[model samples]
Target: MRDRVTEAVPELVAAAVAAPSMHNAQPWRFVHHTESGVLSLYGDPDRTLPVGDPEHRGLHLGCGAGLFNLRVAAAHRGWDAVAETFPDRRDPWRLADVMLEESGTGPSDRALADLFPAVENRHTSRAPFTDEQIPPEIFDELCAAALLEGARLAVPSGWHADDLVDLVHDAELHEAASDLMQAEIIAWTRTGRAGEGPETEGVPAYAFGPRQHDVKVPVRDFGLPRNTERRATATFEERPQLAVLGTEADTPADWLRAGQAMERILLEATRDGLATSMMSQPLEWPELRSMARDPASGLGFVHMVFRLGYGPAAAATPRRPVADVLTVV
Candidate 1:
């Protein structure tokens, strides 16, 4: 059993690293206790976006997404992964500990195992999506997905959705005016020519998608003044189908749960043949994040805003090699 667990560590970490992160930072580390059959997750302090994610909320979210992917990958490999978050208070960087138990009968989480196919297929679609309505039933499935991970998915409509879009616009303007924020974005974005060689992390120029002709939707603009000629212009959905993923409290654990929920929704959306992109612009600022939630909905803190529709598949972002992030003992 111990040997089996050790052998599965590489494949598991590879799937976990495939998860989305802020600017593709991939801010996570994994360690396998070969003797105990335990896999541990840690947040890499160096990979954090200090300016954009000052409180480490986004960092926790990214790690949580990786955790969820780890769970799914384990399930696919016929192991029941029991995860505990923030296992050690003394080590703040230690995020979660997952004990891999062999499933004697079958996969413990068939639902999670079913999502393994979508794990590799899921990519953040920054490109424009067609203006078509997603069925209400699909929204229900997504909401259930979030709830399963201890979070809520709220679909904002009418004036509420419009208000969220305005908040994103406000955040964009705020980012534009703040030199520190702009510098942080530029640092994580690659705008080099084709022959410049590939980056192992960060959003490359090809994945930036086209610049929106209008501000109908809140797609982030990563293009700097130096790369103006490289980006093409296109129109995005006028009234994008937006949903907010939130939790009752804003703590590290809550952030982690929200991250897991967010990834679950993204994977489920991918399975349903929908294109998806996330908007954290508004949620990055405290005031804007507060304004993002619906008072009537009773959601305390908003973590991420999702734009979902039918659009072209997005270009895959780069991820660090597994050898750099995993350790075994």
Candidate 2:
């Protein structure tokens, strides 16, 4: 078992790091204990976004997404991964402890293994989507995907949707006025030409997509700062399809679960031939986040807002090498 785990750690970590993070920071690390066959997931403190995610909620969510991908990779390799969140209270950085066992397949294992292909294929699309309505069945599948990870997916419509859009705009105005937030975004966004430098992490200029001609959705303009390169403009969908992912309680463990759910929904959307992007701007502001939730949905705390529809797939973002984020014992 140890030998098998040793051979699989690299591939697993590779898929894990492929999971999306705030500004593509990729704030996650993996450590494998060969003797005990235990794989540990940690939050990379150095990669944190202090201004954008001061409370580290987004950090834990990113790490949780990585953890979900690790499980998918293990299932694809025919290994059963039993995972526990916050295994050590003394070490807050140690987010999860996973025990890899060689066991026979089960229904849930097969279900997770099915999403393995999407683990690498999924990319956050920032381009404009056409004004096409998603089928109700597809939304149902996405909701089930969130529920599988112990979270709720709510589709806000009518006046609620309009209110949510207003909240997103409010958050955008706040970001525009704050210099610290802008600096944080600039720090994580690279404007250099490809191959000019290592540029392994951070959202590259190529992935910024065309600038929105109108602000119908909550897409962060990474090119907002002065002196940044200008991008082509395109009109985005007027009524952007949005969904809210939430959990019953707001805690570290719930944040991690929400992250897992968020990734699962993204992968499922990718598999279904849909383009997806995230809107965390409103959620970043505590005051706006409270108002972002739908009063009719009966959800407690909303963790993420996702935009889904048919559009061009996004360019793949860069990721740090496995050696930079993994250690073996």
Candidate 3:
């Protein structure tokens, strides 16, 4: 069984690496013990965003996406991948452990197949979204996807949207003013890397959305400093639809769940003809984060803020191949 599963590990890691990250850092590592037929996940400390994700929330989200892919990969290979997150209290590096299970209502192999294509196609769209609203049914479907992963998806109202936007702007400005934070952003961002470069991690130039003359909602202008001028003029939409994913209890497990749900929602949206981008700026701030959650909705805490709409799919960014991220014993 070990030798048999080892053959599947490469494809599994490839699927897992397709997950999105803060700047596409792809901050995850995987090890498979062929003798035990087990796969262990580890978070790359070097890939972590210290200032942006000091609590490792973003790191967990990235890792969680990888875990979701692992499960899908297993299903594709005719095995149910059972995941036990953070199984070892003493081993902080053990993000999750995956094993083969014979029976379960796992995701369909067709869905897993679709996921790989989606993974390759899914890019954060910083481009302008049509002013047209995403249908209520689609919104509900995204909400359901989050719930499936034990999280809540909150769609804010008029006032709520304004408030959240304000918080995003505040966070962006703060990051800009702080030398330390700016340094961290610059460190993660790279123009181009040879084979694999130090700055090979963070957000790339192509992923950066167009700079707005005045952004009401606080989306980061990753184009700042390096690219003063917008690449192509985008017809900015008046009202951009935003949603947040939350959980009732905040724990390492909750963070992991939120991460998985985040990917699910993103993938579902992609399948439904939508382009998406996310920001956790407000949530990084305690007071602002609490306000970001809708009390009326009675959902859990907000883990992420996403902008969704119909737009051109942004260019696919570079990723360190599966061979670099996975090891087979």
Candidate 4:
């Protein structure tokens, strides 16, 4: 079993690295223990966002994406991945341990298998979406995808969408105006370039998606001061579709679930021929994060704000090589 398990290591790491991250910052690591067919997922503390994601929202999102990828790879290889969060009570950084099982229910694997193709194709589209509403049925499917991963996607209506747009714009302005936040944004954007620095994984310049003539969907200007004057015209559309991803709890485990659910829903949407972009601006502030939830919906904790619709697909961002992220122990 050790040799057999070792053979799956490369594929597992490849799938994990395929997970969507905030600005493509693949800030997670994989350690395979050959003695026990247990793959440990760890967060790269050095890659954490100190100012922007103080509570590790982005960190969890990045790791969750990796987890989703791991599941997909496992399913593709005809194996079942039994994951336990914080398997060790003493080690907080020990995120999870994935035990491989050969014979098991195919439900999870089936779903992940369906999403396998989207692993490489799914990306964050920063460009404006056409003023087209995603079909209600497709929306329902996406909602189901989140629910399967223990999360919920709340699609806001007319007034709700408008209000969220305002909240996002306000939060974006606040974050952008602050020097500390601005510096962090610059760091991630600049570091996004391949081989630029140690922080090699992040949203790359090419995937910044052409800048809009005027802000449309509350995109964080990655090249704010450096290329503020550059023109990458986008046809801003009115009434962008808005959906919020929420969890039942707000613990580290819940965050990890929410993050993986996010990628699952995003990939499902991408497979359904929809373009997507996520904005955590409103969730950045406590008050604003609360506002993102709908009282009528009975969901109080919101983890992510996603925009979905038909539009141009954004370019793929750069990613760190598999060799750099995977290590055997």
What is each predicted model's overall lDDT from 0 to 1? 0.90, 0.90, 0.79, 0.80
Cα lDDT for residue 204, candidate 1: 86
Question: Against the hidden reference, what TM-scores do the models get?
Answer: 0.96, 0.97, 0.92, 0.94
What TM value does model 2 have?
A: 0.97
Tens digit per residue, CA lDDT, model 1, 79-116: 88899899999999999999988765553388899999
Cα deviation of 216, candidate 2, in Å:
1.6
Worst 10 residues of 3 by lDDT: 192-201
What is the per-residue lDDT of model 4 for residues 125-193, given as tens digits with 9 covering 90 to 100? 887788877889998998998898998889988777778888888887788688888777777775234
Cα miss at 174, model 2 (Å)? 0.4
Which ten contiguous residues of candidate 4 have the minimum total lDDT?
191-200
Expressed as tens digits, the lDDT of each residue in 74-120 for candidate 3 is 77666777888998999876899898756455455456545555666
Supply every candidate's count of residue pairs whose N, Cα or C atoms clash at under 3 angstroms. 0, 0, 4, 2
Question: For model 2, how does the per-residue alpha-carbon lDDT over 1-329 read when each residue is reduced to its tens digit?
Answer: 78878898999999999999998898898898888888999998988989889999999899989999998999999988889889999999999999988858679899899999898889998899999999999999999999999999999899888888888889989999999998888778888845333489888887887888887776777777634546889999999898999999999999999999999999999999899999899989988899988878989999999989999978889999999999998
Question: Candidate 4: lDDT over CA atoms?
Answer: 0.80
